[model samples]
Target: MWAQAKSGPLPHPITAAGTAPVHDPVPGELYFWPTTDVLAVYYADLGQAVPDPGLIRLGAIDTGLDDLAHAGRRVTVRIDIEGVQ
Candidate 1:
């Protein structure tokens, strides 16, 4: 599914457990669950409906949170630590 989504709509591999229940998924936050291989973002404002639960946190959205509007929307990710450089 991910392979096909490389260019088109990519759907998150929802597992039985789902992502950790984020009561307040802050905008610009990204999460990935290894068990399900699902990637999600908090495109909406904080304290919105929970995306998924039981996901192994992937990372935070540094930029482009506005672009993430839907659930199955695809996105590019980049990781960097503050004060590391």
Candidate 2:
């Protein structure tokens, strides 16, 4: 769990590109995103064959009410996704 949401899409994608993700928080309504199709459908682990974004599920994260704080606002968090190379 990472953020809180009231409704709608998560403020950010789930397990985004990274070998070491800094999980700093978790919420009750939290959920690993980009797992289901409606969110994301594809993902890859670098050298691994790139799955179709429509069929791949590389990661998920937590988002909920915490995100709604800046509702209608723009927030930016950086995740480092990379190639196997």
Candidate 3:
């Protein structure tokens, strides 16, 4: 699943540069495109390749992918940090 900003890029505090941008991402992988401020979560391999500069690796989903795929096309998502308050 991927979401792009309709108006413009959203404000963020990420200062880290892209170290390992991937051309082909696998399932359960997470990525953030800095240029477009788009966030994506791979539930399955779409057989698509990312453009140049590629996508910044965020992390991976260890579980609940099946639930995600079954949640239909649109769903609200909430991200919770472990210790950041």
| Predicted structure with the largest TM-score when compared to the true one | 3
Clashing residue pairs found in predicted model 1: 18-53, 18-54, 19-52, 19-53, 19-54, 19-55, 20-54, 20-55, 32-58
Candidate with the greatest lDDT versus the true structure: 3
In candidate 2, what are the lDDT values of residues 28-68, reduced to their tens digit? Answer: 22223344412321111222322333122333433433344
Q: What is the C-alpha lDDT of each candidate?
A: 0.47, 0.32, 0.64
Candidate 3 per-residue C-alpha lDDT over 1-85 given as tens digits, one digit per residue, 9 for 90 to 100: 3421111233464643738778788777667776778677777776778788887777777777777666765665555445567
The clash tally of candidate 1 reads 9
- Clash count for each candidate, listed in order shown: 9, 16, 0
Estimate TM-scores for all models. 0.41, 0.21, 0.71
Q: Pick the winner on lDDT between candidates 2 and 3.
A: 3
- Candidate 2 regions exceeding 4 Å error are 1-55, 63-70, 80-85
> Model 1, 2-82: lDDT tens per residue?
211112222646443544454344556665544456555555563344444433444576765544454244456445657
Residue 64 Cα positional deviation in candidate 1, in Å, after optimal superposition? 1.7
TM-score of 2: 0.21
Model 1 worst lDDT run, 10 consecutive residues = 1-10
Q: What is the TM-score ranking, best to worst?
A: 3, 1, 2
